[model samples]
Target: MVASSLISTNFLFSSPLFPPRSPIRKLTIVSLHKIPTPSSSHVKPHKRSLLPCRPLCPPCLNKLLLTTRNPFSFALDSLLILCTSLALSLSLLVADVDSASAFVVTPQRKLQTDELATVRLFQENTPSVVYITNLAARQDAFTLDVFEVPQGSGSGFVWDKGGNIVTNYHVIRGASDLRVTLADQSTFDAKVVGFDQDKDVAVLHVDAPKDKLRPIPIGVSADLLVGQKVFAIGNPFGLDHTLTTGVISGLRREISSAATGRPIQDVIQTDAAINPGNSGGPLLDSAGSLIGINTAIYSPSGASSGVGFSIPVDTVNGIVDQLVKFGKVTRPILGIKFAPDQSVEQLGVSGVLVLDAPANGPAGKAGLLPTKRDSYGRLILGDIITSVNGKKVTNGSDLYRILDQCHVGDKVIVEVLRGDQKEKIPVVLEPKADES
Candidate 1:
C-alpha cells in the first residue's frame, strides 16, 4: 500500500504542471514486492523505453511542424516556380527576335537619272550584239582525226533581218568554221558572205530565225564631234554583251589593217575599253545608234590603254553597201604606177614620181611621161603629178586616196611637172584591173 502511494506520488511529479528542476533528476521510490511476468507464452511482451520521455525543444518542435506541411501547398509552390522559368524563357526568345528584326536592312528600289539612261541603253542594244568564235581545223597527231579547234573569239552585230552579220574581217580570216552566239545564247553556224581585207570588214550570214535578229540602229559618223559621249558594246574577252562608255577622243584618225598593209582612213578614236575580243563590236552614240566599229586598241600589254580605234560608220556604210552589192570593192584607179613614198621623200620631191605608165592606159593616153634611163646611164625625171582637181598630191597614197573619191566616169584635172614646165592634163577615171 505504501509502494502504491509512492508510485502515485512519482507520477504526479513527472506531470506537465509539476516538473522536476533538473532534466536529469531521478525519483527513488522503494517497492514492497516484485512484479510478476505474464503466464501465457503466446502473449507479446511490452518493450521498455531506454531514454526518458521529455517535451521537445523549441527549435526541434518548429522543424517537426514544418516537415508535416500540407501537400496541396507544396504542389502550388512547385507550379509557381515552373511558371516563372517558362515566362523568363519566352521573354528571352522575344528579345532575340526583336534584335534580329532591327538588324535587317531594306534595299533601294530607285536609280538616278543618268544611271537609268545607261541601264536602258545596255538593255536596248545588248540584244543586237552577238559573239563570234573562230574555229580552225587541226588533225590530232596520235588519233589521226581532224577536228575543229577554237582559234579565237570576237564580237559582231546584226546588219539586217536577212541574217546578215557584220564584223572585222580579221576575226574570220583563216578560220575553218565560224560560230555566232546570239544574245539569248543560241549559237548558229555562220558562212562568210564577203569580206574587205583593206577595210577590215566582213559580212557573215546565219540561217537563224528572223525573230531572234534585232538590227542595231544606224547613225552617221560624219557629223560626230569630238567630246561627244559614246558607248561600246561587245563580247570583251569572250564575255558577251559588255558595255563601256566614254567621249569621242578624236576623229578622222588612221590605222593600218592587219589583213592588208593599206591604211584604213577616217577612223574614230575613243577612250573606251576596247580589248581583244571586242574587235568587231559596235561603238554607239548616246542615242544607242551605231556610230563606229571597234577594231583595235593601242596597248602594249594587249589590254585597253585608253587609246582605242574604230572604223567610222560613215566609212563602214559605204564599204558595207559596196561589199553587199559586189563581192569586192570597185575602187577607181589611175592606170599609172608611181614611186614609193619613201623614195620620193628621200629625193626631197613634192609630188608623186611617175615610175611607169602602161600603153593604152588612161595615164598613157593623157600623154603622162614615165622616168627613163638614157644610154649615158643618166637618170631622166618623168612627169611629177602635183595635184588632182586642185587637191595636192603629196605621194602615191595621197594620189590614190584622192582618186578613190571619184567615180569610174568622173573627169579630173591633173597638174603635172614636166621638166621645167607645169602642164594641166585631163584624165578619165577607170576601174582597177583585177590583181593576179
Candidate 2:
C-alpha cells in the first residue's frame, strides 16, 4: 500500500506490530475547554471545541495546526512511514514464496526392498524369454498366388546352450515356417526338433550362436507348496516381456491338451495373468527358477481372468527329455483300441472294454481277445481288461497314466475277465506310434 493510505489509517508515529527504533519527543498543548476566552464562551456548552470525538471548527483547527507544527516531529514521521512500508512488502513476499512451493514437482523417491527385488528378477530372466511367430502359406483369392502370412504368435524360453527352445505344441501346430526373436531384437529361423501333442510340449532348434542362448534355471515342482509366490513372464497380446506375479492357488490340477485332447495331470494353477500370447511362457517361483510352463487359462472371453494353468516342470522335464532323445515321446502302450469310458459306463462295465486288437499287435499275440460279431450279426463281447500289473484300470486316462511310468520292452501282467472266469496274461509293452 502507498505511504499516504497507511499513515491516514493510524496517524500515530509508532505502531504496535512494527515499532519505530528512535525515541520520539512528547508534545502537549493546552485544552481549548480549559480556556475561558471570549470566543470559547460564545460556543455551545454541549460541544467542546477540542473534544476527541467532536469535530473542530475551521478557526480552532487552524489555531491547533499552527501550535503543533515542528521540524523535529516532521522528520520522525517520514522515517516511520518508510520503515513500515518496507516491513509490509517483505511479509507479502514471504507469503507468495510459501504458496508457490506447493506447485513444485517432487524429486524421485527410492524404491522399496521388495520392489527392487522384483525389478531385478525381471531383468535377469528377460534374456531367457523369447517371442515366437508362426507363419503359414496361403493362396490369395484374386491374385492366385501363394505367400506366407503370420498365423499366430506365442512365447518360449531357452532350454540349453545348443539353441533349443521350449514351447507349447499347439503354438506351431500348422505353421509352415517359424521364427524366434531374442530379447535383443535378433530374429532367427527355427525348425521343429520334437513335439508331444499329448502333453502339449514342443522343442524348437535355432541355428544362432550359443552365446545368445540363456537357459532358464530349473526348479522342482514336485515339492512345491500351495500359496507360494510365483512370477510369470511372457508376451501378452504380442507385447514382449510383460511380468506378472501371484501365488500358487492349486496343485495337481488337470487340464486337457488343446492339440491331442488328452488329460495333462499334475498341472499348476496360479492367479497370475496369462493371455493368448502367453502360451509356453515360464512360471517361475520367488527364487527365479522355472517351476512350470504356462499353457492355458480358464476364461470365457479368451482373455486373462486371473485363473490360469501351467504344465508342471516335472512333467515337462521328462517329456522334453524324451523328445530330445527320440523324435517323440517314448511312452509305452498296450497296442489295442478300447471302448470309450462313456460307452463302457453305459454298458455297466467297470473296466476297459477291448473293442479291437490287431492280430499282429502285442495285446492280440498275448491272448487278449477282441470283441466281434457272429454270423447272425449278434454282438459277441470279448474279454474286458480288469487290471494291469496289479493296478486297477478304471478308464483310458488311468491306463495311460500308469503306462506313462512304464518303459518300452517291459513285461506286464494284464488281467482280463473272460466270460465268468478271470485270466492273467503276460504282454510286453511296445513303443507308441506317432500317428496314434
Candidate 3:
C-alpha cells in the first residue's frame, strides 16, 4: 500500500490487501490524496507525488498491518486473529446457552410487617367468605330443554354454624335458583330465610356441614373514623376470593335502596374496590372484623370508580336479628296510604296528604280524614299530616323515617291540616298484617 506521506512499508511481504511481494516497504496515505478536476478553477495546478513523504523505516503500525516479513510481526498478527476468532466463538456459545438453569433465582425472604398481617387476615377470614350464584331458568333454543343457568354472582359470609348466611338483598334478586359455595370449593343449595328490600339486607340459609361454616367476627361501624384502613374481600367478576385495601373515605353517607327505592341513612363510604359481583361481600376493618356490607358503587360504566357505599353493621345488626327470629322485618305501620311526595309538592303543600284511611285501619279509627269524591263529581281534600309526634314531616320519606323509629301500640300525636285549621290527633300504631 504505497501512497503520498505514507511509508512504503514492505511491499516487502505479501499483502492480504495490496497483493504481491517486494523487497521495499510501502504504505498508502489515502487521507491526503485528492484528484484534481478541471471543472474546479480553485484547484492548484502543481501536483504532488503519490508518496509525498517517508513515514518511518518500518511503517505505521507495521506489526498490525503485517507489512514486513519479520517473524515477530507475522506472529503478532496471527495471535491477534486467533484471539478475535476465540472471542466470537465464545459469544456465539453464550447466545446459544439460554437455558432456565442459567437464570439464578434469589432465595425467599420473610414477609414484611404489613404484608404478613394482611396475609394472615385474608387466610383467617377466607373460610367465612362464600360465593353466591344467582341462577335463572333458560330453555334451549333447539332442543327445548329447560335448565338452570347462572345469571349473576356475588359474595356472602356465614352468619352462624346453623348454615345461616347474610348477604345483600340485590344479590339474590330475581333468581329462579340460588347456590352458595364455601371456601373449600364445596357447594350447597340455599334458601331465602328473610330479606329487607329497604335496607338491602338478606339472610340465606345453606345446609352445608358445620365443619365448613366459619362465622365472621362482627364489628360496629358506628365508631368507624374516616381515613382508617379498610379491607374488602369478594369474588369480583366471578373470580375467586380477591382482597382490596383502602381507607374509609367518608362516613354517614346516605344512599337509596336498590329494591325499595327508599333512603338508607348512616351508610358507610369507602374507596375499596367494589365491583358488580362484590355487592354482598363484607367490608372489614384493620382488625379483620366485619364493619359493613359492600353494596353499591358510583361509576358510569358499572365498574369501580373509587366511590362505594356499604350498609353499616350497626344498622344491619337490628335488621338481621329481626329477620333471624321472625323471618321478616316487623315494623309498626300507620295503616294508611298517602300521596306521593311529588304530588304533594305540586299541590303547593308542605305535608303528606292522606290519600286513603281505610275504615278498618288505625288512621280511620283515630278520626283522621281521607280524600274523597262528592256527588257533584268534585274532589275533596282530606287531612294533610304536618308532623308525627314533634318531628316535622315534609314528605313521604320523612314520615316513613319518623315512623320507623316508633313501635306498635305506641300512641303519638299526629298533626293535620284540615280545611283552615290545625288539629292534633292521637293514634295507636298497628302492625301490618303481612309483617305480623
Candidate 4:
C-alpha cells in the first residue's frame, strides 16, 4: 500500500467594492500500511494470490480511484470527502475574517475621534449660520399693494454685534422685505445697511440683541493654498444650515462680479457644494475662519457641480471696510475710456487705444485726445492711453482697476499714444460716481 497526498484549490473571485480573497488550497495525506496476518492463517503458505493489477502512474491512479467503485473506491471517496470538508471549513474561516473587516463597528456606540471633532466644529458654528428669505410685493388693479411674493432664499452669517449681517447682494436683489432665521429657529426682520453690487456683497441689519450676534471670525485669503481643507455652512436652496466639506480648488480666478459687470480678479474657487441658497454663506477654513463668501457655482441643473466660486475675504475686507465706514463704496477711478493694450498691438498700434472720454471729464480737461467721429461719418482714431503714473496700462479693465486704487484728487502722469506719437499728460484722479 502506498500513501497519497491529496490537494485541492478553492480560488475566490474579486469584487469592485471589496478586496480580493486569498487563494486557498488544502492537502490531505492518507497513511497506508500492510495489515498484520496471523501465522496460522498462512500455515499452508498458500500460493500468493496475484490480484489482476496494472502499474498506473500517479495521475492515472488518481483518475482511476476517483472514477472506480468497490473497496478501493470507498477509500478514494473518503480522501475526497476529507478534502471537501477541509475546504468548506477554510472557506467559513475566511468568510468570517472578511465580514469582520469589511465595515466599521462602533464599540461604544459613538463616533470616532475624527468624526466627533467634525461634529463639534459644526455644532459650534451652526448657530452663527443663518437663512435669509427675500420677498416682494405686487400692486393690484386698485393700486393697492397685494400679498407678498417669495422672491428667493439665501444664506448669511452674523456679521457684528451691531446687528449687522452680511449676505450676497444678488440674494436680495429687487427684494422688498427680507427675513433672516438663525440656527436656533429664531427669525428676525432684516434691512440692507450697505451694499456693493460690484463685489456682490451686502450688509443687513437685524434687531437681534447683542447676545444673539456672534460674528464669524475672518481669515486672510492670501494665506490659503490649493488643496487646503475647507468647510462651508449654508442654507442650500432653503434647506436649513447644512455643512459641506471640500478643499480650495483654486484661487485668483477671474469671475464675473455679481454686483458689477466688470470682471473680478482674484476670486476664490472651491469644490464645496454651494447651491442656490448658499450664495451669501461663508467658506471657512478648518480653523473656523471665513476665507470667502460663497457666491456662485457652475452647474447646469442649478445644483452644485463640484465647482463653486466665492469672493475672497481680501476683496470682501476692502469692500466691507468702505461699506461700514461710508455706507457706500467710493471706488477710485480714472476718467478715461480705452480698450486693451493688446487691441492696440492687434490693430498694428503700439499703445492703449483710447475709445472715448467724457466731456468736461478729467481726461478731456487734461487735453487728452478722445476718439471722435469724422466729417464723413467715419470713426476717427483717438489718443491711445499707454500708461498711468508711469505704470503700463494693459487693458481697459486693468487701467480701470488700477485707477480704482487711487483716491479722488490724486495727481498722476498719464501717457498716451496720440495718432502715431507717444506723449505724457498730467491728470487728476476723480471720484467714480454711482452709475446706477
Across 234-283, the per-residue lDDT of candidate 4 in tens digits comes to: 98868877889889889888777765676776888888888778899998
* Candidate topping TM-score: 2
Specify the poorest-scoring 10-residue window by lDDT in model 4: 10-19
lDDT of 2 by residue, 1-436 (tens): 3444465446443333344574334323344564444466676566543433235645556545644668566567656766776676666667667867877877886999988988989999999999999999999999999999999999999999989899999999999999999988899999999998889999999998888889999899999999998999999888968999999999989888898677899899999988889999999998899999999999877657858999999999998887787768877778898888898899887888998888777798897999999999998888788899999999877787788789988999999988889999999988766533
Per-model clash counts, in order, read 0, 0, 12, 4
- The residue pairs in collision within model 1 are none
Q: Give candidate 1 misplaced runs (Cα > 4 Å).
A: 1-102, 137-147, 300-303, 371-380
lDDT, residue 412, candidate 1: 86
Candidate 1 local distance difference test against the native: 0.83
The deviation in Å at residue 275 for candidate 4 is: 0.9
TM-score of 2: 0.74
In candidate 2 the C-alpha lDDT for residue 264 amounts to 91
Residue-wise lDDT of candidate 3 within 1-436, one digit each (tens)?
A: 1131122233223334444455335444433434444688897766554443344234344533454467676666656655655565566556556543468665787899998999999999999999999999999999999999988999999988999999999999999899999999999999999999889999999988898899999999889999999999999998999999999999988888999787788888999989878899999998999999999998877657759999999989999998989999877778788888898899998999998999888899999999999999899999999999989999887887888799888998999999989999999999887776
Clashing pairs in 4: 197-259, 198-259, 198-260, 332-404
Candidate 1: tens digits of C-alpha lDDT, residues 1-436: 3444454455444333343464323322222334356799998977743322224445445434434557576556556555655565566667777877889876866999888998999999999999999999999999999999999999999999989899999999999999999999999999988887878999999999999999999999989999999999998878757888889999988788898666788899999888789999999998899998999888876657659999999888887887777856766767888887888889887899998888777788888999999999999988999999999989766785787588876888999999889999999877766720
Report residue 258 deviation for candidate 1 (angstroms).
3.0
Clashing pairs in 2: none
